[model samples]
Target: MRILVRVLKLLVFIMLINHLIACSWYAVGINDLEREDTWVKANDLKGKGTVYAYTTALHWSITQFTPASMEVVPMNELERSFTIVVIVSAMVIFSSFISTITNAMTQLRNLNSERNAELVKLRCFFSDHKVSASLVARISSCIHQSNKLTGSRVHSEGVSILELLPVSLKCDLAEEVFAPTLCAHPFILTWSEYYSRESKRLFLAARSSSLGAKHELFNTGQVAESMYFLSSGAMVYVRGDTRPARVSPGQWLAEPAFWIKWKHVGHASSTGKNCELVSLHCETAIRILSQDASTISGARRYAKTFAAYFDKQFDQLSDVWADVEVLQAMVSEAFIKHEKELLRHSVASRVVKDTKMPGLLRRMTSRFSGVSMASRLSSEEGMSQDEQINLILHERVRKYGVDGQKRREILGTRSMGSDSSDEVLAPVVSPVFRNPERRQSIGRGRFARNGLNVVPGIASAFRIMTR
Candidate 1:
């Protein structure tokens, strides 16, 4: 991009110089109106339109400045002097343009060659060690990403970018870059929403690291010594008997460990792409929290609650994880499996006031009850069984005629109560001795909601075999 800009500036310079030369060429003859020997006057262009004069001047300017194959001859002494000056300027300007462009191209080629050499050596070195091709590719990706993020090549000997910055500058840089995010971190906020600049700085002092795919951050049951922050890329956290969960950017890993004595319940590793992680060690967190021990009442309570459920293993405890609480106050509303039943009952008992399709649970329960009591309701109403079945299976969940019956009311209420009770429903079957055609028709799904020619129910249709 820099090279392109340099070349563009040169092109503009050349065009501007050509424009000045063209104007000067046109002006020379006009300055001496009495002279008939000037190029413009000699060409009988004095009375000619400005177009003709400019065309003639531009012809000379373009040819001389661009150093085209065809050259314009000087016809008079002033023209000769002007030609000499133009020729000298063209030589210097064109020479510089050529030199600048050459240097830029050389630099670009050398940079590419250097990068290619490094990659070739990397691949060769990895291949020599019999590393899998896939892992080598991920390592290459890490190098490219590290170079991009740090704005320089990262060496293999374990030197880090943070070490390059002066101590005070590093603190200021970290404060500027990570202060807003770390300050509002859920765990940090649990300690206290507001902290001194120094307290925040200590959190921001967390160390950063770059890793390749499958680089393990922790082993199962390992002592949780640090909490990880995914700055970029993703990590997969694997807990026993559950699918791996992806930990995305701006999410914390092993957070509870940073606050209290805990061990990693699962393992975590970097994904296919490179990852940049910032880890706050337990010691660092302790030191930071110590500064405001009196204010960390909430954190202390949180640790106690977490310890109470020490054996419970969830997915990676990220901010975006399924059970994350956005607001600190929401911790009070959290419940265990046994507590969920009471909550469901409360929601079920809460009168549904919305006009739209009744509350989700209400609709589900009502639907279940309608189906169970479908055949029974048909017998009482002297209506065909098909009609009741259709009503139950119909997708338009709006309030309808049969849906308000007492049998439906009883069953629907039973469902809404979240009760597991002794109510059982009938199963469909062909009667003991019925018409074969009707039996075949019902067997062909003719009793389904979409069936156009409805099959008869137990009363009119078939000899449904039952004990």
Candidate 2:
């Protein structure tokens, strides 16, 4: 489009120049003719009113000849010169115009041909099965042709990289370079190396079925063998007596018994209407983790730095698993040895202080002693006072409002003035020091005492030993 406009502009310029030259030539010729006519008229006027009888047949008489009475004679030579000059100038201008038009048309035709060839190549590539085989060759040929025509050697490898880079990254990188072609060359090499490494790693690419029916309580403790990555769905993580937490995409859920020596924690179920997940076997994941320590470390760093990026309830559990694995790799140890140091630092930082009773209370409540505590709280017999308090605290912290005053209210703490002004009195019962009786009917005893039936009675016996 721009080339066509420039051609039209050039033609207009040439015509203007030709018109000016023609006007100048005609003006000069007209001036010369006028001067000659004036000289002829003056000479004719001088010879007016004077005539001598020269012929025998004519009587002697005086003729009154004025300027107007003199007949004007045609100057054929001057007229011929003017005609020849105009014709020659016209021919030269016409030839130049024709040449200009022809050159512009040729350029347009060449551009159209190049565009058509590119379109044909693109269509062939899209339809052909040999695209992978021929792509490199086609790119190389195109680059060679372009460089030859432009008289500049372009880097073909760089062009190939730009073609392969994802559009978003390519656009961002393109703006950073002054000479895009040259800069793009090195970037292609870098990208190729990185891509080659990543292509070797295992990835999950599987379809998931719809979770239509409500599931009965699943004993995740018994089901072990696989690790699941939330590829395009959300899940709720229900652990012990605490409220379920949500887990979304990019989070990985591994059964503890399969990966580590710890007891199974909880089960995960779909949170979204239609959940699609990618399941990788436990052994496969462990093998990858063992092979690529750097990948594991990088994943951990990302999770820690962008913890808030995940809104799913299972995010913390996933992060803890990831962090422990990375730290284990970094320290080259089987067990985490820095727990005391971390606690000390937290106390020093005033994140947890002895003087602040609530902080101390929170520390006690959030502590996870072992699987025993978890099993005791989750069983049908219900939780002990300490277990219930721990579960409540876990729910509060998981919801990110553990420090709210409403928590203290739920724990039977009262306002200062209200406690003093209250006039309500309660009867204190004395403990009867009687000998313990052996229970015969275990079911009736359990129901009468704890309001629940005894089924193998594990929850009642699993009590926390206070220090």
Clashes of each: 6, 3
For model 1, which pairs clash? Answer: 430-464, 430-465, 431-463, 431-464, 431-465, 432-463
Per-residue alpha-carbon lDDT of candidate 1 for residues 80-199, written as tens digits (9 for 90 to 100): 898889889888887887888899889878877998998899878987999987997777766765555443224322556657767677667766655554544654543322333444
Q: Tell me the tens digit of each residue's lDDT in model 2 across 236-298.
A: 777768777676665555533222222235666665233434444544534433332231132
How big is the positional error of residue 318 in model 2, measured in Å on the Cα after superposition? 7.4
TM-score, each model? 0.44, 0.23
Looking at model 1, residue 364 earns an lDDT score of 30
Error of model 1, residue 462, in angstroms:
73
Native-to-model Cα distance after best TM-score fit, residue 262 in candidate 2, in Å: 5.1
lDDT of each: 0.53, 0.37
